[model samples]
Structure formats: structure tokens, C-alpha cells
Target: MNLNPEQITDYANTFIKVLIDYSPKLISAFIILFAGLYIIRLINRFIRRIMVKRNLDPTLTRFLADILLWVLRIILFVSFISKLGIETSSFVAILGAMGLAVGLSLQGSLSNFAGGMLIILFKPFRVSDTIEAQGVVGTVSEIQIFVTKLVTANNQTIFIPNGSLSNGNIINYSLEKIRRADLTIAISYDTNIKEAKDIITAVLKNNPKILETPAAEVSVKNLTDSAIQIAVRPWANNEDFWGVYADTLQNCKQAFDDAGIIIQPFFKESSKKNNPTEQLE
Candidate 1:
């Protein structure tokens, strides 16, 4: 594999010529790469500042900024590649093909990502807010790019995918300042309805957590063969809703017992009056 002097010289000359021809493009490429990177950093910092100034969610701001940063870097890389005597059209075509393939393979993930973006943008619920979605109700502990973490009353953590969460019905209990607790109280058919309502109304009035502005009310809901159904509605702040609900019921029960209001066992076993859902506004 030995070469004569003439052949070696020819090879050396060719190498030097190629280096001389490409040195400027190579140097320009390096300069452009460094400059582009610096500009990208500045742009990312500026975007972060703007998001902070607008008081955007910290998680969403970081997510969006990182996405923009990578997109800009990819563009800069293409430009740098083209500067070094490379064909950018083919590079772009390859990138497009790769993007399409990756996108297809990650359809569900992309869907979740988009859903996360929507959740962050529209803000159906936020961290520390109580929400019911996809048949699960809990306090939102964290909102991530792909899923939301919920801490249930039982102290269990559940991850709900952003895709389904964004698409499904969401009940945000904390969105409103005030919520109404509805309790269905069942009394014997012979018990005085007006007297029972008055007793429950008194119970609601005495509770500190119940809101006086809305004026809690009790009304006859239905009548059964064995008992009568009474609807007790009390308003409270979101934080006091469950407290108001449980306390009002307990106080009404004690009050009823004192007033000789008979709670029929038949109603207790069958009626779901006490299980009425809380109303949020």
C-alpha cells in the first residue's frame, strides 16, 4: 500500500486545497452557531420575563419557553448546517419526514400534550382546587404537561391524563366563592312540616360557617308512604361547604330530637335526601 512521492504529494495538495476552499464556510458556520445560540438564550430569557410579568403559571411558562427554545435552536442548526456547503432542503425534508413519523407514533402523547396546553391556557381548575372529572373527585396537587395529579380525600394520589381530562366534564368546586349544601331530611308523615322547616332553619342560622347573605331555606321535597322528605339548603364559602353541610345536619338532628320531630326509620333506610349533591355557583 506504499505510494510513490508523486502520488503522496498529489494527495497532500488535494487535502490542502479542500481545506482552503472550506475553511471560510467552516469558520462562518461556527460563528453563526455561537451567535445563534446566544440570540436564542436572549429570546428565551425575554419570553420568560414577559410571562412572569403577565403572572402566568410557572409550569406553563417553563413548558412554553422550552418548546420555543428548541424550535429556535432547530432553525439555527439548519442554517449552520447549510452554511458548511451542505444541502438544507434535503435536511429539512428529512426532518419533516422524521417529525411526521414521530408524530404518528406518538399520537396519544401529542393529544395529551395539546390537552395539557389547553388546560393550562383555559384553567378549568388549578392546583389546590377541588375538582371532579372522569368520575374521580379530588384536590389538584400538580398540573404537569401530560397529566394532572390529584390527591383524594383518602390521601391517595391519582394521575389523570390531560387528554381525557380536557375532553371530559369537570366540576370545579373552588371556582366559585360560595357553594350550597343540600341535605334531605326525612321525618314521619305525621310530623309538622312547617315546624320541622323552622327547626332546620334555626339550625342553619346558628351555624357560624353558613352564610347569612343568601338566607338558608328548608322546603318540603316529597312525601313517601312512610315518611316526608325535607330539603335543607344552606350557603357557605367554598372552604366551609363540607363543614356547613355536616354541622347543619348534626345540629338539625339534635334540634329535631329536642322538638319531638320523629325521624322515621323507613325514610332513613330508603330515602337519599341527605345525599343531595352540593351546588356550586
Candidate 2:
């Protein structure tokens, strides 16, 4: 079908009319989009400065700023679409439903991320700090977004989910400058308790790693069927804890041997002797 002059003119007129009608909204949307992007940048920079001033962790700062930037941009995008006379309620609802689905599917990951954020913010433990948490005792090597890496004394690397780590009991041994080392020394019932205590006390005092300000003490902790338990309390710097502990045990054992005091390993053997069922196992 051939278009007449009137038909061509009418089509042109209709196109011009539509453009004229939507020109302001289109222009406004473009202006708002650019302006909103600039504003978001400024806001992100301002937030980063504030976080830095507050001494927040660098990782958390970047993560939070990125999240905020995206959230703000999403809102701005919705507003821009609304400015173009498009219905946004359905769009927002769809977005919300999609967000819910994603959140549900990544629930554990989100929880771990939140846990990591909390841990970084609160600093319950720091890198290189010896901490006991979730039944694992190790030095924290890295604190990631979803997990914390720990290096055990045996040089084993353990990855603990931040969710459980943040929620569980954390014993930070390196948080304090000083720590007390508790050792239970079991001696034969026939040995002299006072002499054993004196010898242990001397050993603790002689060790340079042990702190003298608290005055190390040795006392009777318990008495078993065949042995007397002595509790040796020694104070040392956090870094010297393991060293002092090992030295104390070695020195005490040597001292006991020299003093003719018997260190008994009778608890398990005595139990086995008393329980005939143990041998069967």
C-alpha cells in the first residue's frame, strides 16, 4: 500500500507529539541519574572518611561502603524509572521477591558475613593472637569475610566459620599482657608434700620467664587413691606462656627426681586395676 502525503505528515506529527510530551521526563531522568551518581560518590567518600576517623577496619570500611553505594544506586534507579512515568511498585515488588529468594538461598553465607563484620568491628581476637574457641585452640592467622583461619601449635591450618566463631566462647590468651600457667603435678602419696611444694616454688622462682610481681605459689590441689596433686601457679608474659610452662614441668620433674620424690602415673593404672572391665577393652 502506498502512503499518501497526508498519511506521512500524520505519522511525522504523531512522532513529534510523543517526543514533545516525554522530553521533560526523559531530560529529568538523565539529569537525576547523573546527579544521583555524583551524590552517591560523595556520600561514599564521606562515609569512608568517617570510618577511617573512627579507626574502623579497612576491610569492613570498604565492604560497608560498597554495600551502601549499591543500595543507594538501586533506590536512585527506581526513582529514575518512576520519573519516566513507569510503574515502579511492581518493579520494586519483583526486586523484593528476588532479594528474598537470594537471601534464603545464601542464608548461611549471609550469616557468616555478618558474623565476620561483627568480629572485625568488636575485635574479640586479632591476627596472631592465641585463642580457644569452638573446642579448637590456635593462633588466629587470618580473619576473612566468612571464615577465620587459625594455625594450631602443631602447625595445622583450621578454617572456622565466622558465624560459629562469633557466637561461641572465645578465650583470647594474648589479649592480656600477662597470663597464669596452671600445672597439676601428681606425686606419690608416700612423698613429702611440703618438700615437693618447696622444690616447685624454687624452680618457678629461678625461671627468668616467670614474673615475680605476683609471687608464684604452689599448693595442694587434690588427693587421689595413689597420688597427691599439687597445683603450681606461675605468672608469665603472654609470649612466654608456653616457654614458662614447659620449663616449669621439666625443671620440676628434674627437681623431684633429685629430691627422691616420686612423680606417680598411677591414676590410670590404678583405675585399670580396680576395673576388671578395662582390660577387656
Candidate 3:
């Protein structure tokens, strides 16, 4: 079909008129889009600086800043769409539906996120703190949004979910400035308890790592058929706890040997008795 020139001109004029009518709104939308993006960036930077000044956890600071920027950008985008003669209610409804779907599918992740927020806000433990949770003990290497990383004493890395960590029992060994080293050693019942205690006490006193304020003590804790259990309690700085523990045991053993104190081998004797022929031999 062939159209008349007049009809073609009329259609062109009508299109031009519509464009003219919407020009201002279109221009305003573009301007707002650019300006809103710039403002969002500025706000994000300001928030980052504030978090840094407050010495907040690096992971939490970055996560919060990114979330704030995205939320503001979403609002700005909705405003821009509204300016271009689009109803924002439908857009918001769509977003809500999508969010619900995502939340349902990632329920565990959302729980971990909430747990991480709690950990960051309350600070139950911090990076570099040695903590025991969920039957695992390690130094906290990093605290993340979903998981916490730990490095064990044997140099094994463990990733624990933040959800369980937050709800479960956590023993923070590094929280205290000082820790007590509790060790038990067995000596033959024939050994002189007073002399053994004196030797152990001297060893504790000679160690510089052990804290003098608490004053280490050695006492007979229990008596069994084979030997007497001696409890050695010493206090030391948290950083020096393992050192003091190892050194104390070594020093005490040497002291006992030098003092001629006998350490009974009860388990060995019991095993020998279990084998009548070996015991007889």
C-alpha cells in the first residue's frame, strides 16, 4: 500500500511533538542518574573513612559500605525509572519477589550473615585470638561474612560457619592477660612428697616466664595404687603459657631425677601382670 505525503508528514509531526513533550523528563532522568551515582560514591567513601577511623573490622567495614552503595543505587534507579513515566510500584514488587526467592534459597547463608553481624557488633573474639569452639581450637585468622578461618597449633586451617560459632560455646584463651598451666605428674608412693614438692617449687621459681604474682604451687592431688599424682599449678602470661608449660614439665622431670625421686610405671606394670607368662619371665 502507498501512503499519501500528507499522512506521512502528519505522522512525523505527531512523533516530534511527543518527543518535545517528554524531552525535559528524559533529560532530568539522565541527569539524576549521573548525579545519584556520584553522590552514592561520595557517601560510600565517607562511610569507609568513618569506619576506618573507628577501627572497625576490615571485612565488616567493606561489606557495609558496599551494601549501602547498592541500596542507594537501587533507590536512585527506581526514581529514574519513575521520572521516565514508569510506575515504580511494580518495580518494587518485582524486587521484593526476587529478594524473597533469594532469601529462601540461601537460608543458611542469610543465617551466617546474621551471625557474622552479631560477632562483629559484639566482638566475642577478634583476629589473632586463640579460641576453642565446636571442639576445635585455633587462632582466629580471619572473620568473614559467612565463615571464620582459624589456624590450629599444628598449622592446619579450619573454616567454621559463623552461624554455629555464634550460637555455640567459645573459649577464648587469649582474652585473659594471664593463664594458668595445670599439669599433673605421677611419682612412686615411696617418694617423699615434701621433697618432691620442694624440688618442683624451686623449678617454678627459677623460670622467668612464670608469673611471680600468683606463686606456683605443687601438692599431692590424688593417691592411686601405683603412684601419687602431683598437681603443678603455675601462672604465666598468655603469650608465654605454652612455653612455661613445656619448660615446667621438663625442668620438673630433671629436678625429680636429680633428687632421686622415683616415677612409677604403673601402666607398664599393669600390662605385664595381664600377661602371666611375661610377668613370670
Candidate 4:
């Protein structure tokens, strides 16, 4: 309380000297940080525009953009923290310790994510394609990063994980312009093979939608206990599959009936009303 003037002057001078000493480092760090951050933001935006211009997959573009921004943020954050007198070694160590745990917990999900990326890149199938995968057959409606959705021929919706789709076999029937229709018809053993083949061939030949290139094949496929099975295959456009299928079937039946061919229903014999005891006796 007694030496007030000198003490006050000394304290003020000392404070000013300390600030001047560290001001250079502080200012340098601030300038470097601001410039680096601004450049990072600019680079991220530029990268996004380039990706879009290249017509890259929207999901992939977004993912890459996020990664770019995160990397820049990490660099800036470490530098800023160091300026504030905090060590980055301990921070990086903590991150390394936790990263493994997080990755393990999300292993399955991450695998599916990778699978999704491959699907988008390779494009084995797309929306509206009829595909058979994971033992389910349906028309694809949406293919997302995590899952793929399908609508069945009966109008049922099915969702499959991207991992399963990529890991398993997939059959894309809609990719082809023409699909071969396989039909099996059975007739009584007494029926003439020549007449039946001719009649079936004529039925398919009458339809213009059926392709003549493959040449509809009609051959006796099997000789069962009481009937002869005929194998018929015809090629037609994908859009006309169902229509051609029904028409070809109806025509074959009509042709067989006109030629006096009797189609023996397989199960009628075992369930025949005739008494077995009487026949045996």
C-alpha cells in the first residue's frame, strides 16, 4: 500500500512486454489458420463441381465430398489446437484407440456400404429390371446405397441388402430382347407324334410375335406310363412374354383338340373310380 506508484508502473510494463513477446507466434498462427481454412472450403466446392460435371454417381460424389471436407478440417483443427498449446500426439492416440471399436461394431453395415458402392459402379442391374437374386425373383424398382427393392410379378414388394445381392448370383432376365418360352404338353400314348408336332409347330408359326430365327423346337421329351410329353420352346419379345405365353398355350390346346388328341390327366388313373377288387377278382 505504501509503494503504490512504482509497483503499478512495473506491473504495467511487464504485462506489455509479455504480450509483445508472444504476439508474433499468435498472429502467424491465426493468419495461417484462416488462409488454410478458406482454401479448404474453396477446394471442396471445386471438387464437388468437377464431380458433378463428370457425371459421377450422386452417392459416390457426395461421399467423396464429405471425405475431402473432413480431411481439411482435421488438418486445420490440429494446427489450431497446437497454436493454443495443446499437443496433437495425445489427440491422435485417443482417436486411434476408439476407431477400432467403432469400426468393429459397424462391420456388417460397412460391408454392405462397400457392396452398395460396387453395385452402383458396376451396374449389374437397374430399376425396372427383372432379376433373380438370393432365391427371390422380381422386377427391380429402386437400388439404393444400402438396399435394393423389387416388385414381384404378382405385385409384391421385396427388399434385399446390398451385401447379399453382390455376394450372391444375380440373373437379369429383362436384359435380353427375346426370351425363350419353355412349355411342356402331355398327350395320351396312343396319339400320333408326327401329327402332334406338326400341329404344335403350326400354332407357334401363326403368331408373328414369335421369332423364326431360333426355330420353335418340338420334340417328344418323355414317354411316361400312359402319356407322351412334348417339349416346345419359342422365342418372343420381353414385353410380349405373358401374352405370347397364353396365346401359344391356347393355340396348342385348340390344335391338339382339332386333331382328336386326348390329353390324359396324370392323376386320374390312381384315383380311378373302378373298383380294384372287382378287376382283380
lDDT per residue for candidate 3 within 130-231, as digits (tens), equals 998987888999999899999987788999999999999999989999998777778897888888888998999899999999878788877878888888
Cα error, residue 43 of model 4, in Å, equals 6.3
Question: Which is the better candidate, 2 or 4, if ranked by lDDT?
Answer: 2
Cα deviation at 46, candidate 4, in Å, is 5.9
Model 1, span 59-99: residue lDDT tens? 88999999999999999999999998899999889989999
TM-score computed on alpha carbons, candidate 2: 0.79
Q: Looking at model 4, report the run of 10 residues with the lowest lDDT sum.
A: 272-281
Single out the weakest 10-residue window by summed lDDT for candidate 2: 272-281
- TM of each candidate vs. truth: 0.90, 0.79, 0.87, 0.72
Ranking by TM-score: 1, 3, 2, 4
**What local distance difference test score does each model get?**
0.87, 0.87, 0.87, 0.82
Candidate 4 residues 180-234, lDDT tens each? 8776778887888898889998999999999898788899877778778788888
lDDT of 2 at 157: 92
Clashes of 4: 0
Cα deviation of 1, candidate 1, in Å? 3.4
| Model 3 local distance difference test score | 0.87
Clashes of 2: 0
Model 2 C-alpha lDDT per residue in residues 20-80, reported as the tens digit of each score = 9999999999999999999999999999999999988776788789889999999999999
> In model 2, where do residues sit more than 4 Å from their true spots?
1-24, 120-122, 266-281
lDDT of 1 at 181: 79
Question: After best superposition, candidate 1 residue 151: deviation in angstroms?
Answer: 1.5
